[model samples]
Target: MRIFVPGDAAAIALGADDVAQAIQNAAARRGLPVEIVRNGSRGMVWLEPLVEAETPAGRIAYGPVEPAAVSGLFEAGFFEGGAHPLRIGRPEDHPFLKRQTRLAFARCGITDPLSLDDYRAHGGLKGLERALAIGPAATVEEVVNSGLRGRGGAGFPTGIKWRTVAETKAQQKYIVCNADEGDSGTFADRMMMEGDPFCLIEGMAIAGIATGATKGYIYIRSEYPHAVAAMREAVRRARKAGFLGERLPGSTHSFDMEVRVGAGAYVCGEETALLDSLEGKRGQVRAKPPLPAHVGLFGKPTVINNVISLASVPFILAEGGAAYRDFGMGRSRGTMPIQLAGNIKHGGLFETAFGITLGELVDDIGGGTASGRPVKAVQVGGPLGAYFPRALFGTPFDYEAFAAADGLIGHGGIVVFDDTVNMLEQARFAFEFCAFESCGKCTPCRIGSKRGAETIDKIRGGIDPGANLALVQELCETMKFGSLCALGGFTPYPVLSAIRHFPEDFGTAAHLAAAE
Candidate 1:
């Protein structure tokens, strides 16, 4: 019997390691032969330690399982594969798994990511095939029509960025995948890199094809050691299979990829800083206008896209652009792989077409907080993202709606906080976090953030509380205008949002009461 089990970090942490070993032991004692393939996560993290046994109908899922239960599968004749209590029918049939509009994540959980035949069978290089046939201009048009934007906070149009690189006449061009997922609660990039390394490879290849770039780099964070291993293995597999490297199957396009490990800096996720780091220099932000498209990566025309943005490309090439554009509302076309995290009841990856509200994502999908207290505030985007009170929960989780509501969906990282959470403390942490993580390139972000933290602490102690509040407001404004990067510019979102939304929580008496 062929059994599929994921080796996702979260699943392994939940004892998938023991479960896999147990399954092996069960087969050995039963005198039954079993083929176990450890695949990447399917993104349904809640159902992790999810084991799948191939049955006559489809792959049956047995999830969140314990090692002790492995013997039961053998007694139940799971290898011959009759239904078991742990069986949730087909893996695809689960509600959370079923509702997803998985374009970029198409090959994520389903395929043996390393297998060329498996990837091809599942519509993998059909995009590269089509791109090789139609050529670059047509490829760019399809991307433009797809209406896909960068999943990274900026939300820049990906197609337009590609066109700039394609048009720029240069001897060298580069394609960089910014996979340094530094946002507090965001992990879509990490999950995708870990779960489906090939999709990212394919996406980068497509980006190279469209823009006439010969080399690519995936800037993954050092935090994800397993993902690094998976990506490295995938690269080896791709080159061996002729899916990557010179003369990619059925095409003359010669492209190569390298995985660059990040130094755990949040600001490095920004394209400019990422480029600086990639160039073997201190990760400092460069001024814009000579954007990455024209002058990037050692003075070459380069295309730098977020992990999700690049991963979405293969699907755009395989399926028509119109199909992708059909999903989302307004200009924010196509599905977004929204990462739900922090104190959330059903926190995991939820990918859908744009248009859902904060209310739906937080209450309906998340099932409220894990603590079961009333959710006090929701941090949309990241540390730099705005913290919306219950009043703004009605706001749609889209670019325009969020901006109109005095917030930014920076990275689609919705960190839900319960009533027990202190907004003032959370606000203080935001400044503290920025103070530590800021790249020290600009004055407003470098100095203002540290001072802001000190100022917030003074307010917490009721040491000239009214004066401290005024100081914070002034500092936030200065950072907003004076900072060159979002690190400083958007820090004010969390600080001001907390002050504005939960005024009572910031009072000295309230702080004293909480301590008592």
Candidate 2:
């Protein structure tokens, strides 16, 4: 009998380790021969420790399983696709899993992350093979035609960035995978890294090949130790397997990569700052004129892409760019691994086409708020993302659509909030977060965030409510335009959006005063 248990951090946090051990113990007690394979999460975090038992039909899912329930599961004939309360049948049949496109995440949770053979069996290295066959220039063209964009906040075209790097005349070009995923309620990067490390590896390898770069680096945040470990092992395995190192399989072009952990600075999530941190310098945003593509990582040409952006390349390459582009709505082509977090009941990673409405994501897919109350607001991006009220829930998940709604799809993290949430506090928290995480490189971000928090405090205290609110707005405008990096520039999104959408929570005095 084959039993699958998630080795994903979220699952482990929810006591998956204990559940795995319990399964082992229960199998021992029953004297049944069982093979326990620690696979990546299926992204159904709510049903974590989502144990899967392989039967004649397929992998039957039993979820949110506790250690104590192992005996009960065994007694109920779980190994043979049991009739237990925790049994969730086949995972792919679940409503949440059924709705997703699962292109990039197809192999995640279904295979042993460290097994190269498993990765190959699930259509892994096919992209690299295709890239090798088509050659670097064609590979670059494929990405360009895919209409892929940077999944890390900024919606810059991925193909354009790659084309820039590919066209650049450089002695030593580089590919940097920005895995420093510090966005609030965002774990898609971590999930991809931990679940399917090879996908990221394949993506980076393709990037290196396309851009004529011989070296690549995955700048993962220090917070994600599991991701770090998984990636390091995957790299080693890939290197040994000839997928990496001096030359990729069936190709003369050479590409190798290493995993580098960041110092846990949220500002480093910015590309320039990440490049700086990777260069052994303090994390600080660099002014854009000569962008990272031209001058980056030791002053050479570089292709800096988000985890999802690069990971999507494998699929784009394997199936052709047009195949990948056919999934989503206009401009925002291809699927996104949207993470549902905070007060949502069915919180997990939902990978789907870009045209899904905010209401469909929050109410229909997320199953509303976990508090059993009406959702008051949903923050679509990171902490710096806008606080969208129920009225704006009609907005589509597309980048341009969110931008039109005065929001962003930053890392595709949607944090839901119930009616009890105070928008004032949420707004204040955004300021506080920016203040704390600011790199202190620019005056607008370093000082404006602090002042913004104080001004919100003043409004909360009912002190010169009208003037203070106006001042706060003015400060936000300054930060929005003047800040060096997104750490400061995007900070205004939540504050201004909260004030615009939920004026009542900012204090009745401020609301009435603004009315006058």
Candidate 3:
């Protein structure tokens, strides 16, 4: 019998390793034959360390499994899909899994990340194969038709970025995958890298082919050691299997790639900053007169895309652009792997077509706050994303829709908060984060973030509340329009949103009452 246990970092942190070992020991004591396979997470984080037993019916899941319960699980016949209190039935049949429209993450959590055979069995390499057959120009055109935008905060069209790189004249072109996902409450990039390394590899290979680039690099964050290791091993396996390095099988173009780890710097998540860090320089944003596409890595044309943007390419290539395009609402045409985190009860990754309402995600999908209190606010995007109160919960999860509502779908990370949350403090945290993570290149970000935090503290302390609030607002506008990168420009999002939606939290309600 084959048993599956997640090797995902989240699962590991939840004691999946111990559970796997316990299962092995239990099987050994029982004299039962069991082949344990460490696979990627199925995106159901609340049920992590979710163990699955292969049976005639399919993969039966038992989740949040502890090592101490392994003997009981064995006694209860868990290996043969026997009845157990921990049993969650088939993973895919779970309400959380059943609802998702997983495209890029289809093979994640389902396959052994290191097994090329496992990847191939689940429709891997098909996109690269199609790309190889169709050639670069058509490959570029296919992505253009797909209407996929970058999933790493920026809503820039992935096709337009690729077309720029493809059309540029350069002796040495490059494809750079931005794996430096530094946004708060975002883990999709890490999950994808650890769960389905080959999918990323295949995606990057497709990108290299599409952009006429012979070399690619995945700039992963150092915090994701598991992801970095998994990707490195996957790259070795892919290279040996002829999927990378020199000419790919059945293709004339030669493409190769390597994984590089970055120091823990939030600024590096920016495209230009990432390119700088990749070039052995301090992670600082570059001015945008010449975008990365025109003169990128090593002064050559480059295609720098977010992890999800590139990962989605394999599906687009294998299934055709229109097929992927058929999923989402206007402009936001495709699936977004929305991450539910913070005070949510059913916290996990939910990949679905765009247009799902914020209320549906926060209430129906996320199962409300874990604290069982009314959700006060939900921060969509990342730390820089706007803090949306229950009033704006009607907003759709689309690029234009979120922007229209004075928010952004930055990295698709939704952090829920109960009524106990202090919006003033949350806004303060955003400024502090920007201040601490700023690259110190520009005055607005370097000076404004620190000032913003100080001003928020003054409001919290009831020091000239009205004037301080106005000062904070002015500081935000300066940072928004004057900052060099998103570190400062986007810092105002959470702060202004908090002041706008939760004025009471800033001690303004009592003052207004007194004045009246």
Worst 10 residues of 1 by lDDT: 507-516
Which residue pairs come into collision in candidate 3?
40-109
Off by over 4 Å in 3: 509-516
Error of 1 at 182 (Å): 0.9
Positional deviation of residue 254's Cα in model 2 after best superposition, in angstroms: 0.8
* lDDT by residue (tens digit), candidate 2, 241-285: 899998677779999999999987999999999999999999989
How far residue 476's Cα lies from its native spot in candidate 3, in Å, is 0.5
State the displacement of the C-alpha of residue 34, model 1, in Å, after optimal TM-score superposition: 1.1
TM, every model: 0.96, 0.99, 0.98
The lDDT per prediction is 0.86, 0.93, 0.93
lDDT of 3 by residue, 1-516 (tens): 999999999999999999999999989988998899999999999999999999999999998899998999988988779999999999999999999999999999899999999999999999999999999999999999999999998989998999999999888999999999988789999999999999988988998998899999999999999999999999999999999999899889889998999999999999999999999999999999699999899888999998999999999999999999999999999999999999999999999999999999999999999999999999999989999999998999999999998899999999999999998899999999999999999999999999999988888888988888889889999999999988899999999898888878888643473355
Q: After superposition, how far is residue 71 of candidate 1 from its true place, in Å?
A: 2.2
In model 1, what is the error at residue 325, expressed in angstroms? 0.6
lDDT of 1 by residue, 449-515 (tens): 9999999899888798877887898999999999999999999999888887787888954344335
Model 1 residue 489 CA deviation (Å) reads: 1.1
Q: What are the RMSD figures for all models against the true structure?
A: 2.9, 1.0, 1.5
Query: Which regions in candidate 1 have their CA more than 4 angstroms from the true location?
Result: 80-85, 508-516
Question: Scored by Cα lDDT, where does model 1 land?
Answer: 0.86
